[model samples]
Every structure is written in C-alpha cells, then in structure tokens.
Target: MVETMRRRGSSKGRALDLIRSQGPISRVELAEITGLTQATISNLVRELLADGVVSETGRGESSGGKPRMRLEINPASRFGVGVDLGADSSTFVVADLAGTIIGRLGIDGPGALGPADYVRRMADDLAHLLDGLDIDRAAVVGLGIAAPGPIDREAGVIVGAPSLAAWSEFPLTAELSRLTGFSCVLDNDATAAALGEFWLGATEVGSTYASVYMGTGIGAGIVFDGTVYRGSRSNVGELGHVSVDARGPECPCGNRGCVELYAGPHAVIARAREAAASGGIDLEFTGVAAADFAAVAEAAITGHPLALALIEDSAEYLAEAIVSLVNIIDLDHLVLAGSAFEKVGAIYVRTIQHIVGERALSRHLQHVSVRMSVNGTDAAALGAATMVLQEQLSPRSLQSVTLA
Candidate 1:
C-alpha cells in the first residue's frame, strides 16, 4: 500500500510538471508524453482538477470524434516567493504557479548586519509583502533565496560570498524556513537567473544555453539538456574569475586579469569616473556608483563618444570571455541579464554578437545567438521563485540547479 501511494505521488508530480511546462495539453498528449495508459492520465487529471491544481481550458480538435478537453496548471492554486539577495539591496518577488510575478518589494540588504538580523529583516519584508496581497498564505508552497555564492546547497548554508561575508557559514535556508513558516531553498544568483530564463524565458525545452549575469560581479549559469550543469561542488560557472588578460591587474581571487575586473558594473563605473575626472568627457558625475553607471549608460545610448567608448570597452572584454566559454561549452545561445544590463544592454548584446560571430571556434559550424533576458533585472528573483516550484512540483532533483 505504501509503495502504491509513493508511485501515485510520483506520477502526480510528473503530470503537474507536464502541465506547467506544456499546458493546454490533452490527456491523450499527457499519456503520449508520459507513456502512461489513458486510464492513468484520466485518473491523474481528475485528481489534479479536484485539487484545483489544474483547470480545463477550452477544447482541441479531435481526430474523428468529439473535441478533446485541454488542461493547464491553475495559476492561482499556489504561490512562491523568490528573493534576490544582493550586495547592496535585496529584491523580493511573489509569483503564481504559472511563474508570473504578482507582487514585489525591495529592501536594503545585509551590508553590516549579522546573520540573525538579516534573516529577521528578510522574514519581516516577506511577511509584509504577503500580507498586503489578496492571495491565500496557506497556498504559498515555499520560498527560494538567490544569493551570491560559493554555497553549500545540500546543507542549505551560505558557505562563502565575497561581498556578503556576514552570511558565510550561515544556515540561511533553515533560518528562512523557521522565520517564514514555509520550506525554503537556496541557490546562487547566476544559477537562479539561468533557471529563470529556462523556465520563463524564450529558450526551447532541451536546449543548451548560458546566461551571463552582470551585476555587482559577473558570472555565468549554464543549462544543458534541460538541467542546470552545476559543477561538482555547485561552484561552477564563475566566469568572472576567468582570465582574459595575462598581464592585467590582480584579482582578489589571486588571479591576474579576471574578466570581472574589466567588465563588471563596478569596473565600468570606475572607468567612467576616471574619464569624467580627466575632463575629456563633459558628463555629470554622481558620487553613487550605480547612479554614475546609469548616467554613463544613458550617455552611451545617446551617442556620447567617451561614454560609448567606456561601455564598448567593457563589452569587448565580456565578449572575449564569452567567445572562450562558447568554444569550450559548444553553446549556441547566450543570454545577458541582471541589474547592470538594465540600461544600454543593447550595446553589450551587439558587441558580444559581433565578436562571437567573428571569432568563435565553431563559427563555421553554427551561428551563435545573443539576446537580453526578458525579465531583465528581475531574472534572478523570478528564477528563485521557479526553484521553489521545481522543488515542490517537479520530479527532477534541484541538485542540478547550480552554477555550472
């Protein structure tokens, strides 16, 4: 009896995942996809419908008889919270079962605060966001937090983060779960962004791609064969530390000429500040680095030569790293995402496309495609939400949802 129940639960999870991934599908299609009998599909669909997990849409054309009823995951059946914990700020988002953001909030991050205080603040913000919404709190399945890593995902601990030192060795997932009274999951920001693109962006199922996340730092999230290619320790895809120049400046990671030093937002803003100080560029300087980067991005978009030069220079370094990555991974599609790409993303897109097209090792074999993320700055947060959905509803293990 126990074995039968477990099997049924597994089948139910699979059926729900199918609806979420390729919904508006008929029972016949589900049976075909799952290799289950028509009776099993009917039984599963009936249970899902009764549970409010799925709803019948209209009907599809039939072969010879009556039209078949189409079914989809009910968007209102459940909710998930995703948090992007950044160096300077944290973004909180609430998403429905359909992976749509229904509400969002942002607050200052744990810059100087200890682990306990940071967790309390996050829980309070999450509670406030949920309380303000009209949805049922009981329907919330879980919370997913995306933070900068080297994380100990299995242990649910933030092992280390360069900027967020106070969070290191912190039991982030357990603390969040305790404070929020919901199960919680933890993932690196870049990996979450990659999964977000795969789950919600335009990528086709079973396609191999990489999302290069450029925020305070640079990293890549690699998804191959419908799963994130998290390396052995889940610390893969640290593309920022990839060496682009042998004789360039030293990196904190004990490397010379890491790509992040040249292409990260901080680097771009630092260069912009230097340019403004040189009196060659007639742009106003905001002491705030993020604001300064935004001004420089605006200038670049408006055809200012100096600002354009700074952006293009950053893009060039990024492109070089991308070319090397593509050659190694044999990837054909690349996504640029994160807060840094919120403005003047097109310039980076164009530069990366041009360089990859011209210099990729497989240029003669296939054309590489580069595009901006649909979710833009919110990709990580959205991906974090998707992680919760995947963990709760999907059959696949999220152990694969890591950096590689």
Candidate 2:
C-alpha cells in the first residue's frame, strides 16, 4: 500500500520478510538467516530504519558481549485494507505492519448481483468502514481483495470462476482502485488465507504447508519459505475443481465429479434440503448458502442423524481431494479455514485426518497435522489484508498514494 510501492526479489525485501517472520531478531540473526555479511545486513537495516519500516524492540540476552538490540516491524508505520467477497458476506479489515487487525467489518455477500453492482456496493461499505475506524487514513497504503478464482492477478479480474460467473472478465482491481482512490490488488481467497496464516497465524517459518479453505467453493493456498506460491495462472489453489470421477455431475469449471460438486457447502446444503423435503430431519433453511450450511453443521453437532450423515459425506468427499493434495504437494501441515468449517469443523477434520493418515503417500515419511485456522471465518479476509504488508515489506517504488 505505501503509495504504490512494489518491491520483490530484492535483498532489502528479503531482509524485511525475515524481520516480519522472525523478529524481534537482531542484525546478526538476520545476516545468519539470509547468509548476507554483517556489513550488508547493517546497510539494509539502516535503509529500513530510515524508511520507518522497523524499530528496535528491546535488548536481547547477552551471549558474551553487551546485549544485542532486538528488532521488529514497526506496527504503526503502515496499514492495509483487505476485503473478502464471499457468496454469503463480504469481510473488510485494516491491519498494520505487525499483522494485527485494528478494525473489521462484515456485510451482505454478492448474492445474485453482477460485478458492477457488487463492486459498487462493496466500495460504499469500505468507505463507511474506514470512516469509523480510529486509524490514520494517510497511513493506509493499499487495498487487497480475496475472492473466488481463477483470477488474473496480473490483470486484476476474475477469469473463469464458475461460482462468480457474472464477475468473469471484469476488471475489479481497476474499478475498486478508481472508486476508493487506493491502489488495489487481488488474489484467490484460499491463497490469501494461506498468506494470512503466514503473515499472522502461528506457523513454523520455512515449513512447507497448505491451507484448505471452504467458502462458496473449496480451494487451497500453499506457502513454502514464507512466500505464497503462484502457479502459472496466479491461481495455484483450485482444489475444488479437481475431478474425482470422470462420469459424475459436471461442474461449471468444465469438469465432472469435481470435489466441490460433491462436498462444497452448496452441495451439502442441497442434500440437507432434499432430506427435509422427504419428511426427514428438518433443519432451518435460509436462502443464504453460508447460513444454511451452518444450520446443517449445527444439526449434525447436536446428533441429527441425517445432518450428521450429510456433513460426514461431505467430509469423506473432501478427504479424497485432500489426500491427493497431500501427495501432490507433500504437505505436512494443513489448516481448515473459511465459513463452512466454523460449526462442524471437527467432523471434517476427523474424516480428513483418518483418510489422509491412512491413504496419503507421505504417511510413511511424515504425519500430516490437520487443524482449524485460529482466524476461523476471518482467515481469508485477514490474509487479504496481509497482502499489503507483504508488498510494503519489499517495495520497489516510492510513489505516494491517496485515498478518497
């Protein structure tokens, strides 16, 4: 955000990424981690200090000589905006350099609106949200969006997301930037969740892991050595679209028997509603997919046989996709993130654990740890905000940006 700055793959950027991940650390530790000489580390640290990007937190314990000055990201130096556009609701958050969310807001989701209407309403909500949070608007650098994919991250538009069909080919970043007067960037929600986990969630640095997110559709985001991996399409984590059966129901993403077809919130809710229609265990139905799915999960948790069966069925289907993901990425840690997991996450976790534990190819080499995101439903939104922190930590330019 810091006024249109984007620095990547630079020595200074590397130093900053390390500082955020591994600080209150010392320059000596930075040098050791980066393998840069002490002199070079001092130079980079000086530049960062001059930019107000870092500060000395305190003195660390002495080994032999005087205590070393501990360093960390200056939380007050910059702030970022993150917006998660979901089928049920949109989440907005503002986070500072240290990865703490200072403010958050949630509003109705896209529903049936086309891109134009949705973006217009979203921008209005964002303006309202910022006006109320007690933060310096001038300190806000840029905006980040977490949305359904496959997105053209370079182009700032949804390319071919079946769930967001109306948004395909729409230049969301350009329009949002114009409306808010803040430079904007967009990424897949699941990918953003993974990065959010990296930026704010407690995870081992340099460890290879993946976050499987279930929102309107299922997806995943992978991180290795603290950077989110963007495949050729900048849409690396479309796990939902992965086909499990060649002859099953066709998905809008041009596949048959996709994971989402059998296991996504929409499918699970549809199944629950069908059971209710047949004089089965009735659960409350809301037109909103996320809310309705939550009802089903709640029913399952409370011992409704039909609800439990439906949720477990979704879990089993997801395990098939996830076991394959474990083998493909060789992932050792997995986070279940997003709205669908909030109510009955343990069921999905239990099912996935059993399947992955027994069927994963890497089961012999390592054990996969399955857990829920501490951020819960806010994972994608928080991850969206952290995108700004990532950009500022490695900025390449110094242009000033203004907000409306």
Candidate 3:
C-alpha cells in the first residue's frame, strides 16, 4: 500500500513539472504519457487549477468521446517585467505569466550615465512605460533586468560591464525597485536569454540547452537538467573571454587572444573601419552607427573579396569557440541570438554547424541542433520580457516569491 502511494505521489510531481513546462494537457493525454491513472491526473490537475496556475482554454476536438476541456497557463493571474540593458540600447517589456508581452517599451540607453544616474533614468523610463500600460500594477510579480556583465546575481549588482562603464557595481535591482515599487530580479544578458529560451523558446524540448548571445560580445546561458545554472558568481558563461589565440590582441578583461578581441561586433567593426581607412574607401562606422560587419557580410554574399574574407575569419573564430563548448557541454541544442548574429548570423550558423558536425564528440550521439533563435534580433529584449514570465509562472521560480 505504501509503495503504491509513493508511486502515486511521484506521478503527481512529474505531472506538475509537465503542467508547468507543457501544461494545458487533458486528463486522458496526461494519463497516457505519464502512465498514471486518469483519476490521479484529475486529482493533481484540480489542485493546480485551484491554485490558479492553470485554466481552461475551451474544448479540444474529441477523439471518440466527449471533448475534453483544454487547459492552459493563466498568464493574466501574474506578470513580470523584463529589462534588457545593452551597450547600444535598453528595452523594457511587461510579460504575463504565460510569457506573453501585453505591453512593451523600448528605450534608447543613457550610454554615458553612471550607475546611479542610469538607474534613476531607468526608473523614470519604466514609470512612464508602466503608466501607459492598461495592466493592474498589483499583478506585476517582479522585474527581471538582463544586463551585460560581469554580474553578481546574488547581490543584485552589475559589476564591471565594459559597455556600461557607469553601470559598474550598480545596484540596478534596488534602484529600479525604489523607482517602481516592485520586487526585482537581475541576471546577465546571456543567462537571462537562456532562461527566456528555456522557459518560453525551448520549453517543449529536452532539459539541457544553451542560449548563445552574439551581441557586442559573446556570452552563453546554460540550462542544465531543467534549471538555469548561474555558476559560482553568476558569471558562468563569459565565453567571449575564452582564449582562442595565443598571440592575439589584448582584451578588456585582461586576457590576450580572447575570442571577443577577434570576433565580437566591436572587433569586426574595427576591422571594417581599418579596411576602409587603409584602402582609401569611403565608409563610416563611427559613433552609434550599426556595425559595418553586417554591410561587409552583405558584400561578401555578393562576391566582395574583402568582405568575404572578414566574415569567414570571424566565422572561423566563432567556430573554434563553439566546437570547444560542444565538447564540454554536449548540449542538446544551441540557440544563436543577438543583433550581431542577426545580420551575419547565417554565416555563423552555417560555419559553426559544419565544424561541430564534423568535429564534436556529440556528433555521433545526435547532430547538435544549431539554429537561430525564433526571437531573432530582438531576442534579448524579448527574453528580457520572458525573464518576468519565468519568475512568475515557472514552478521552481514561483517558489522563490511570496505573493501579496
């Protein structure tokens, strides 16, 4: 009897995980997949439904019986805010429990604002955006800020982000909370993007995955065994700092031959500017201009020799880093994200896919799925919004908050 009860309890727990990850399933389908009795599935569904996490979304087509009511996550019951603080810009998105962006505000960053002033500016921006939204302020469960880093997630501080020099040791979470009067959570841009994908993008897939953010710099977010792993100091996936060249140029992170010094958007743009200047060509990549790497890439696609060489070199450097990563993590999938990748991303995807397919050990186990993020160019911002949804809606994250 006790063994039977234990199995029943285990089934319920698995059911909850599924509902949280892939919910709105009917009792019959749940039973078939979970191998639990329909009665047990019904019991747990009732509990979740009562807790206001799940709701009926009309009836599904019947399969030789009365149609079952379709269940779905109740996004309106809770909501969270996502803030993506990037070198070039900042974005704010308010998301419901279902990871839907009901209201959004994208802001140009105060590039020169220091930590204190930046937070204050962010506060004003957030307030202005919130005021415009038709949502009830009370249902906003928290705010999740996705900032470039080195970061200290536990302390809620952004530490030594090169792009936002003023954001160093910035108590962004506290300041934003003070400004908006809501609980706030903070994470590195890549990590938050990983969570965004894990929770909303690849939630239907396997447990382990990586979200690679290819922005001004390269960073990765790791989801392992169904949880976001932030590492020792929330600085786990600083992949850009990986030394791919022994005699390469110096990096701001005090490393020589770091990948960022070679392949990051800054590096690519610098190369473009250098080429333009040395060749006496008329091209401008100065001051807040989109990186010329994209233009160079386009030129390469059209048979421009110089542009093709530059992109190929960048892709090779990226391939080296990605190959190393696949060996270490053997990830089930790799999501290429960020604006840098958005423009010339195909080259990256194709190049990395070829290398990893030909080299990584996991190539035999399963062909590593290297694909562009569905969120595309605005992924960080969208993921920033998703950060809110995960915290409020995901079961594990929900445990961290105390609802008022």
lDDT, residue 353, candidate 3: 87
TM-score, structure 3 vs. true? 0.85
Model 1: per-residue Cα lDDT at residue 96: 89
> Candidate 3 at residue 146, lDDT?
84
Between candidates 2 and 3, the one scoring higher on TM-score is 2
lDDT of 3 at 251: 80
Error of 3 at 174 (Å): 0.8
Question: Clash number for every model?
Answer: 0, 6, 2
Q: In model 1, how large is the Cα lDDT of residue 227?
A: 77
**What are the runs in model 3 whose C-alpha is more than 4 Å off?**
1-17, 20-23, 27-53, 58-68, 201-204, 289-303, 397-404
Clashing pairs in 1: none
Better of 2 and 3 by lDDT: 2
Better of 1 and 2 by lDDT: 1
* Model 2 C-alpha lDDT per residue in residues 63-178, reported as the tens digit of each score: 99989999898888888899988767899998888778888999887777877888998889888887887666778888999998889988999887876777889999999999
What TM-score would you give candidate 1 relative to the actual structure? Answer: 0.93
TM-score of each: 0.93, 0.92, 0.85
The lDDT ranking, best first, is: 1, 2, 3
RMSD of 2: 5.0
Please report the candidate that would top lDDT against the real structure: 1
lDDT of 1 at 200: 72
